[model samples]
Target: MKAWLLNDFGLDNLQPGETPTPTPKPGELLVKVGAVSLNFRDKAIVDGIYEPASVPKPLIPVSDAAGTVVAIGEGVTRFKVGDRVNSHLYSTWIDGAPLPDAPAHCVGMPLPGGLAEFMIIHETSAVAAPGNMTDEEASTLPIAALTAWYSLVDYADIKAGQTVLVQGTGGVSVFAVQIAKALGARVIATSSNDENLAKIAALGADALINYRKTPAWDTEALNLTDGLGADVVLDVAGGDGINQSVQATKAGGKIAQIGFLGGQTAALDLMPLIFRQTTIRGIAVGTRTSFERMNAFLNDHVIRPVIDTVYSFDQAREAYEHLTRGAFGKIVIKID
Candidate 1:
């Protein structure tokens, strides 16, 4: 089988080559990967910003993929051979409250991942692909879609008529906007480019803010909300952006902190959090249950993932480069 292996913990070490195909262990399934989706964490792993759970060698490099089951291990009954499936990005975090030790068991970091022709996953992590989606669309769901779903549906409990603010036009933000709209909530999307803003509006965004022109987007958002601010803010931007996120939310509103795209460290004022009774929750990629719920939602609503571009399997490096260059949607790599 062909796979992209990290020879070492650096960007320069990510190289494509051949590797032996893996077999399913007890309670695991072997999937013949059809497509793999790239995420910001992929870049962080290659750049050595996020270290793997343990120091290892010859690591396969991706977590999100959609494929058909080629074989099943002993004791597996949830799925059979030839079932179309997408596995959770973090296969080990199964159910209930997140374990304090989750970071150590994440896939793509410590464990072998999907950027290969074949990969094995525990049967507990595999969920049926949404009926209406293709392999390319399904590939985007395991990480980004699940993250947005967990934030909006599980954590924030977003309801109809509420206002949800989605930052940027990246994978998670796009999914957030679509999901919020599907749930009957008004969506406010922010983008640096007017073209991207226009695109977002066409995708059913109630309002669009060009952050490049309106540097004080928090004030703009507040004005849009008639001084009440948004009910729920999906804050992907970090650093001083956290303070801005606090300002953009209504008193007693929620902010789901999902990423540090702007920067890691931030100078934040705790006064609003104390006095205004604000809630800020940090979210990581979701568990298997969230992934299953997201698929069910997509199936019921017939929602499709917004794919920026599809690259051939041989162009996996190019796909990673495109992600680093900041594409607006999911970057897909087709295997078969």
Candidate 2:
């Protein structure tokens, strides 16, 4: 089988290579990967920044994929041959809270990933792909979509008419906007680009903030919400901006800390958190159960994922490069 392999910890090391096709063991499925989506973590892994000591060299590097089950192991029951499925990010996290060993068991890291033509997946670690979506679209769900869903639905228990402030036009933020709208909540989107903000508006964002134009976007968010602030603020930038996120969030509201695009550490102010009782919850991707629930919600709302670009399997390197350049939504690699 053909695949891209990371010979070492660098983007240049991710070159095309040959590998044997893997067969499923008991309670597993052999999926013919149709498409794989790139995430920030994928880039981090390639650059050797995300848990570099733990990453196995000569590994395939992509966490989320969608494909057809070509074969199933002896005990497999959830899916059979010919069923479409999406790869779960965590191989061990089945339901509820994530298991202690979840981080060590992720796909595209210690385990082989979807960059290959075929890969083995445990039956419990795969979910039925949405019937209405193509493989490219479904490939975006395991991390970006599920993170947004887990943030707004599972943690926040977001109700209709509540305000959700989506940080930017990245994959998770776009999904956050669409999901928040589907849940009947008003969405306020922030982007450095006005064109991107307009695009977000087309996706049902109630208000748009050009963070570049209005440097104090937190104050703008408060004004947009009649000075009460957003019911939930999806804070992707974890640097100094996190302080602004607290200001943007309504009293007693939640801040879903999803990404660290700005920087890893921040000098966070505790006064507002203490006074307002704001909850800053760190968001891991999500559980298998949460992925299933998100799929159902997507089907009900007819919300398709926003795809920024799709590269061929051979163009995997280019796809990673594009990810670093920043994407409006998701970047996918199609295996044909």
Candidate 3:
């Protein structure tokens, strides 16, 4: 089988070559991949910016994919051969509760991931794909969609009539807007691009802020809520945006910190946090259980993933480059 292997830490070291096909061990499933999706984390790992749970060389580097089961190991009763499935990005975190430590046995980092023709997944990590989605659409669910679902639904518990603010038009933010709306929350999306903002509005977002035009988007968001601020803020921007998120959140509101897309480090003011009793929670990818819940929601609501583009399996490097270039939605790789 041909797989894209990372011989060293840099993107320059990524090369395509033949590798042995993996067989399923007990409690594992061997999937013949149909498609794989790229996330910002993939770019970070390739650029040596992401540090895995453990240090090693020669890693297969992508977590999110959709495939058909070709074989299943002993004790695997949830699925069978010929079933279509997707693996959760964080394979070891099976529930919504916080892990005992950082680096929760993440796929594409410590473990071999989905960037190959054949990949093995534990039974615990597999979830059925949503009924209405194509393989390309289903591939985007494991990382971005699951992360958004965990943050908005599991952590924040955003409810109907609540105002939820989502930052930017990245993969997670797009999913956040959709899921928040699906949960009966009023969604407010922010984007630097007018085109993307228009697209977000079409996806049931009640309000849209062009962050570029309105440099003080946080204040505008507050004003839109009648000076009360949003009930929940899904924040992907990690630096000074944290301070903005805190300020834009209403008293006792929750902020789910999900990524460092803006910048990793930031100076924070604790005044709003102390006075308003704000709750700021850090969110990792998600648990396998959350992935299952998200799949159920997708199937019930007929939610479809937004894909920016699709690349052939052999064009994996180009797909990675496209993600780094800030594609508006999820980038997918057709593996079969």
Candidate 4:
């Protein structure tokens, strides 16, 4: 089998190598990987910046994948041969609360990932891919799409006719917009690029703000909602931007803290948070059960993942580069 290995912590170190095809252990499944999706975290892992002390050298580095089950180990009953499945990012968190060591058990970091032609996944950590989607489309669900769903549906308990504010045109933000619209919520999307804002508007966003033009986009959000604020805000940008999220959210509304593109550390004011009783929920992908529920939603809504680019298996390095260059939605690598 052929796979890309991160010999050291750098994009240049991610080179293709030969490895033996792995056999599934008890309660596991050996999958023929059809596609692997790149996330912002994948880039940080390659740069040795995301918990570098824990990431192992010569590791496979991608968390989300869509594949076909070729063989199932003994005692595996959840799925059988010839099933199309998506890998769960949190390999051990089956349902309910996450495991204490969920970060250590995550795929593409401490655990081997699906960058290879074939990879082994615990049967409990795999979910049936939506039948309407292709492998490349399904590959984006495990992290980006599920994070959006978990944040809006599970954390916020979003209702129809509510207003959702999503920041930027990144993978998770795009997914959030689509999912919010599918659930009958009005969407407000923010992007520095007017072109990207227009693109998101085409995807059913009720309002668009060019954050670059209007630096105080939070105020714009309030204006869009008639001096009230968004019912739910997806705060993909952390750091001082958290203050903006607090201002953009309506009283008693929820804010999903999903990413740290701005920066990790933040010194937020306590006054507004207390006054508004805003809930800032931290999202770390989601559990396997949540993934299954999200898949059902995708199937019901017929929501298609917005793919920005798809690279061949041999172009894994280029795929990572594209992630850094930024994209409108997800970037995928087809494992041929």
Ordered from best to worst lDDT, the candidate numbers read 2, 4, 1, 3
User: Residues 257-299, candidate 2, lDDT per residue (tens digit)?
Assistant: 9898899899989999888889998998899999999999999
Model 3 lDDT, residue 268, Cα: 82
Error of 1 at 175 (Å): 0.4
lDDT against the true structure, per candidate, is: 0.87, 0.93, 0.86, 0.92
For candidate 2, give the lDDT: 0.93
Segments of candidate 3 deviating more than 4 angstroms: 52-55, 101-104
- Give the least accurate 10-residue stretch of model 4, judged by summed lDDT: 96-105
Superposition error at 80 for model 4 (Å): 1.0
Counting clashing residue pairs in each candidate, in order, gives 0, 0, 0, 0
lDDT at residue 304 of model 4 (Cα atoms): 96
Give the poorly placed runs of model 2, Cα more than 4 Å off. none
Candidate 4 segments exceeding 4 Å error:
none
**Residue pair clashes in candidate 3:** none
Model 2 TM-score is: 0.98
